[model samples]
Target: MLTEAEKAATLWIQTGFTDRTVIQAAVAEPLLAGQSVVGVAPTGSGKTLAYGIPALSRLVPGAGLQLVIIVPAQELAIQIRDVLTPLAKTLGLGFQGLIGSANRERQVKKLREKPEAVVATLGRFVDLLEERKVVLEEVKTLIVDEFDSFEPDALRDILSFRRGGLPKQANLGLFSATDNPTIVSEFQAAWPDLQVINETSTDNSRGVVHHLLLDRQQAGKIQVLENLAREKHQRVFVFFNHKHVLQKVASELRFKHVPASMLVTDGRQVQRAEALQDFRSGRVPLLLTTDVAARGLDVADVTAVVNFELPDTLTTYIHRTGRTGRQGANGTVYNLGDDHDLRDLRKLVGDRVALETEPGEKKAYRKSAAHSAGADETRGVERQTGAGHRPGKRLTSAEEEAASAKKRKKKKQRWRNKKNVGKHW
Candidate 1:
């Protein structure tokens, strides 16, 4: 009694996957039937394949641009393309990606071949549409990944695309980890009969995440990172509040011979790809980045997430911590800051996050980090307690106090800079 699309999905699952996840199973039939759907699932819950498999199953080979998937970031677009390539191949479908940084001429050339599917970022996709390089008349399904992350202007563009570019009978799919009511209302207004599938209530896809606090002075954070890097099996994502701190920490770690990668929002695309590849392939164990660059990052082996400093908002906190403990993989979240920062983090997350506070579980890691300072010295880099100078010997109490005062001043400046960012300094 299986439909063709269901039978195709069964083949895909039998090929490699063990079984369909809840979100995947729920949305497959509807999506395959060409019905519009909004799927909300937890992070790393295989939303890609949930929508991707059904979409591909419904595609006709050699069709010109039948499926258009819009993502918020270039990296995510590439990730999806890479993930679905094998599946697309199995279905005899040609898939391609349109990202802002990739060569425009090359993309246009590829478009002439009549690819069946295209994954893209909004900016580049819009540009192609404006240039008449892409035709949506034949498009059957349009998917927007991470719908909640789109800005207002981008959302307007998406609405315009749905109205003007796409065919009247085309299906729309929106997927995100969290749903904002206002955005959902806007979509519902646009498509009054849109179907919503919120799996968060019964979603058991996320693994256990140990939220532990590492209450250390700013100077000692680098030493702790060094300690973590010594662990060969740990792949950590270190989040920072500012790009400057990320740059400094990355530089210091590299100077100490730690194989760490740095990813920035405005960096060159090739370098960004290289950095991500290095981390993904286990060539480097640490990836230090800010929120913008790390958004929607889906790496399976990320065993730990380190908050170099707490994020500015709760949504940001959720996105950062969600990087770990993904897809039923047990992971750890280490919040690295002073006591004041720890209190602020608790206030920011409220009852949503459970921080480990037991003496044995929490204090054990702190004790280990403190004792590892001596171990770091054997690598020929002295323990750094603050920015600027590296003294040959350890600092006295007065020096430590002065360093703490300077650190406080720097934090205030950072806040001011953040508030005044994008304005004339």
Candidate 2:
């Protein structure tokens, strides 16, 4: 049932991926048939190729702008352009990237040439559209990658063109790793016949990933990172929750002569590009970044991902860890935090990924009654801390309680003595 174009496109990409991912299988035929689809697949499940192949199949060389792929970040725009450029070339189609922090004059010059496809950041694309440098009337397919991450106003402005909207026949494709009901509903209302596919439930593309917990205080974070950098064959992505913290960590790592690069979403485009390039080429083993900057990155063979700080939400954790273990490759996720941070992380991820102790770690996270039943089934040994406990000794619940009571009594007595000495009994 494949169209001639679709058949040719599929054959061309087969050499890259051994098997079709769930998202690819579910979306290829429908998209090629010009059906609007909203695909929700796990991160690293090959969403780019799933959408790219079909989009290319429908392109006509020298046919003006027929496809517009909108992404959240500038880096992501460039990444997608790099990914699909060769495929587009094989089909005699022209593809170019339009992003912020790059040369607009150059992009406009390329636009003048009538490229068939464009991967663009929303803001930059809108600027061009407003300036009348690009037109959407001929655009047959519009793909919004990481749809949930886009701001509604910017997206609405682009979709509801000032001159007019996209051609009525233009089909849409929205893709993301996580789902936002509000965004989905808004999009669904715009296209009543939108085929919503939830492949996360059935998508099993993840590889053997080990989620490790490294217990370290805030002060020891730099030392831990320095040690991780020396590990052989480790292409690590160090994630941070805040910009200030990421900056501080990056400064410290650089001072320590650790060959780690930092990537910030708001930084200079050339610097960000260079950092990613160095990391990808293995000239550097560590790349420090925030979730926003690294969202939807498709870097290969990321041996490990270290959380210098705990992620803010479960979705963030999933995206961060999903960077590794891509395409059935073995990877590790190291979480560097204190006991309190570890507890918060355990609660955030819940029973989704088991948090195991680092090898040779004598003390590991102890499961409390508040943890889910599945979380208690950890392979690591339980950790205990209280007064009168030996370095490597285990204590029963009752014994631990007794020790706590004794410590509280001693502390109360000391406080009373200090108050009496001050004549405040």
Candidate 3:
């Protein structure tokens, strides 16, 4: 007889239309059978289902919420919700989303009702725990998605929930696409006998083609962007280091007549959702964003990725570029950088990325900008501007002292003449 997990896996395969071998294996033999498990797989590797299938399979129908998935961002929570919600419905399981910027009152009410599963962000989950609005006593399985992204404070808050008490034999699963050596080592040290599943080396090389373009200046970047936009005509994701830069890039693209939208951390939930939908539907040709959209977003049909500014970490770079080349599709990543960035690019991707030279015209200095032969254009008027005519001229120290002395002498002479006039009076 097939086990409950097997039954769920079969249903998932039919509904989702892909066979996840590792996920199936994990479900067949759960990590909590005496040990913890950490799965390191790249984006679009069906990680959510890897943990979700086993979690939902373990749930008893009509029981209280027993599973919780903690993600890094609210957008990711929603993405996971969208994917797992269908499976939950198919299996007749109830789930609730506990992310930020949602109806907190409704979430509190739902917690009282006790759904079968809860997907949430770390901060909001901590808030709920502090408010006593949600109890984790019934949670037998906890999945922390993108564990590498969790800061020390958030991790402490997560551990604090145990202060209230935890399940006797609760299972913990940590999943991430990029592996941070320190974080992975720390986690392993904490749980000495944890099982690690690595599927990155095999999966990363099979699908994507990475390209690194060495652009000397902003003009070169704009030129490359325009070329790619016209050629691909597919959903493009452009990443920047700052939110303001994302906004600026989006605005500049729009000004250049490129249909672009932005996704940043400061936007409202509905606004982010609408922007994502617009990009996914091909209504927006370019999607400008920061690292907020780098991880856990499952936008289909992203054809190319442009790194307007490279991220500081290798994990960030991988996740940013992972937006494209999904699901065995032939996608391209263009890294736009100046000469100073080439060394970092080489260290991150090695020789895997093809190096392309900037155009000659792009490298050549502009003749128009060089000092023209005759008069200079000043506020649309011709002026004989030169080094002498330029503002901020400074006097020598000696010249300054002599001018002061002359003024002092003239003042003294005027006072003496005034005294003589007084004597004559």
Candidate 4:
């Protein structure tokens, strides 16, 4: 008999996932045997198909909520739903996305319809559990995408698990582009039989060129960006560490008449969804977003990733760059740096990132930038190349604790005042 991955890939026929990667193949072995799995793989290496195909092959027809997929963000939930829904249809399965920003009454109506699979943000899923609109006892498998960022304590509110009625031997699939030791250790301690898989790659950054531009107090960052956008005329994802900065950069891009928008994680689901749609459809070619877009965002044909400011963590740096050069496509990554960023840059990307005075044109120094006379309007001057090595050490102590604590507090607050959490009616 053909294995589950083989069977599904064969049926996929260049539809969902034509070929499986190393981690995808490795993850299949255990899922075929109905075992729990946790994995770490490079971003954009087909991580979705790595888990989706196996989970789909195991979908239970007419089984209420047989599969529960928990994601870290509403955008990711919708994106995954979009990717898996078509594949599910190819196999005659039904799935629903239950996110925070959508109508609950409609979702309750869909609940009446009993979708075999559900993609949900952890908070919204807990909300449904509290309202008794869904039963987790029917869930045979729980897949946590972006598990690294998913709060481990969110599992404490799961109706079935909390009530000691969790579906018998329920399987788990925890996956992410980066690994969180705290999250993984907790999961392993809870499920001693779980299988673990991690892939560390230096070449995943291959086919990508890295460039560094020095900004003295970010004086010329926006102008440098505008020049690139006008010359390249392609989609670019610019990352800012702060929400306010993201808004400011996005506004500057728009004022400069660059087709641009911003992505805010905590923003309303409807609004954020629309912005992403506009960017994806090429209605806008530039998106200014925070680190939330650093991982699990699968925007197609991004020509470059601009780090308006580099993130503090190396794993985040890797994921930010991972946004481009995806699936073997060539891309350029622009990193803005300064005197303070030099030591950190050397530690993260090392010699692979080439330093430059600026890209395209070097004009007479001015308070406001203007294209140099005799400069190529194409602005295709210097092209330098570089590659990255490995993930940085564990994040700062405060950051680690804060992320976990915030997740727990959010989960707790969502359920504390809600009645019927322990009732079925």
Candidate whose TM-score is highest: 2
C-alpha lDDT of candidate 2 relative to the true structure: 0.76
lDDT of 4 by residue, 332-423 (tens): 77776554564466567655444333433232331243333322221233222222111222212223334533553467532113231101
lDDT of 2 by residue, 116-178 (tens): 999998888888988889898899999999887777797676557523658888888999998
Residue 160, candidate 3: how far off, in angstroms? Answer: 2.7
For candidate 4, the clash count comes to: 1
lDDT of 3 by residue, 101-188 (tens): 8988888987776778889998788898778777778878778898888888887766565556557566778888877677666655
Give residue 52's error in model 2 in angstroms: 0.7
Worst 10 residues of 2 by lDDT: 381-390
Q: lDDT at 152 for candidate 4?
A: 45
RMSD of 1: 9.7
**Clash count, predicted structure 2:** 0
Candidate 4 ranges with C-alpha deviation above 4 Å: 1-7, 14-17, 151-164, 202-206, 211-213, 347-425
* Model 1 stretches with alpha carbons more than 4 Å out: 1-3, 358-425
CA shift of 311, model 1, Å: 1.8
Clashes of each: 1, 0, 0, 1
Residues forming the 10-long window of minimal summed lDDT in candidate 4: 416-425
Candidates sorted by TM-score, descending order?
A: 2, 1, 3, 4
Alpha carbon lDDT of each predicted model: 0.76, 0.76, 0.66, 0.67
- TM-score of candidate 4 against the unseen true structure: 0.78
> Which residue pairs in candidate 2 have backbone atoms (N, alpha carbon, C) closer than 3 angstroms, thus clashing?
none
